[model samples]
Target: MNNFIKNLLLSNFNKLLQSTKIACPKENLHNSNRLKFYNPGKVTYDGKLNCGITSYLTSFMLSYHNIDHKVWLSKYGFGDYLEDHVHITTNSGLLIDTTYRQFFIDYRSDGNCDYYKYLFETCEPIFVGSPNEFDLLKKSIERQNIKVFGSLNQDIKELSDFWKQDINITPKMNLYDMRKSNEIHPTLLVEIPSLIQPLIT
Candidate 1:
């Protein structure tokens, strides 16, 4: 992707991100223990909470704009066994994750989480910039010998279908409708249902 197109995609992305209703629950924000995660001066919401919803909105934006991309589903690093996270890898060579702060705030700080270090390369609010960077993150996961599903390639429609079932959202829902809904917490959506998995032999 040329600089012009990349810049344009980035511009659109920032606009959508700013317009989207991403937020932290008021109660959580008030909790002394969880207070640090919600920075009132910058964004009142929690990044960890918006991870999934923001990803799909981002992917669809790319598709509609004629930008080629692949949505990647990964183990959320913090969830019930059925959980997985979503992100985008654009053909233009950009790796996107709008809610990366969530990873650090949600898991990295917990020293009691013995497996936390193994789950992610850095929970320090950094993003994977390119496919090569993404691969490094994957390598880190492998080096730790984690058994989680690192990431699976998926189509937009498949993810949309999952959302429809998980949150009464429609597959054909447009970006405008999605943005109008303000915020749809990922916690309310289940990525892959256990029933959808085939039994092992």
Candidate 2:
């Protein structure tokens, strides 16, 4: 990646981390408590969780720049827990993780959380790692490379069709802190981002 472009990606991702809130519930229709990490931008509010959603947002930005990237799923997160760990590697030779602090810098409970009443943002959520961190992660944890994409489009129709359930999303404060303010990402208001990684698409 060009220095300028890498800097730009970092700057924008940090802005999103400090400015946006994710609507990821403890329990969704699919998994145990994950909001389909690919598209946790809905409502229910979480920060330290959903690295995949963070990756999607970052990958979305990369895609907007016409940068190709690949998504990967880590069976376990940085900490020793079965957290929803998913992130991306860009063709620019950068490993970007906007939601990394959730495990490394913040507190993660073994089970259950009260996100509605709690503010999970303790420190800055931006983390751009070199090959070292990526190498360490590879040796320690188990993960799989899913798919690479030139761009990812929101598929709300597909999710709605498959779920066929009423989404009772409660509002919350800044999770990623993109600071469109009052709620979440400005883009998320209009375009629903795709989930982190569903079993199928």
Segments in model 1 whose C-alpha atoms lie over 4 Å from true places? 2-14, 22-46, 76-80, 106-128, 134-201
Give one digit per residue, the lDDT tens place, for model 1 in 114-172.
Answer: 23333332332224366566556645544433333333322211232111113312233
Off-target runs (Cα >4 Å) in candidate 2 are 22-46, 77-81, 106-124, 133-201
Q: Worst 10-residue stretch by lDDT in candidate 1? A: 192-201
Q: Score each candidate by Cα lDDT.
A: 0.42, 0.39
- Candidate 2's TM-score reads 0.42
Tens digits of per-residue lDDT, candidate 2, 51-113, equal: 545555565555555666665655523476433455556566666655543332112222123
| TM-score, candidate number 1 | 0.43
The TM-scores, one per candidate, come to 0.43, 0.42
Please report how far candidate 2 places residue 182 from its true position, in Å: 22
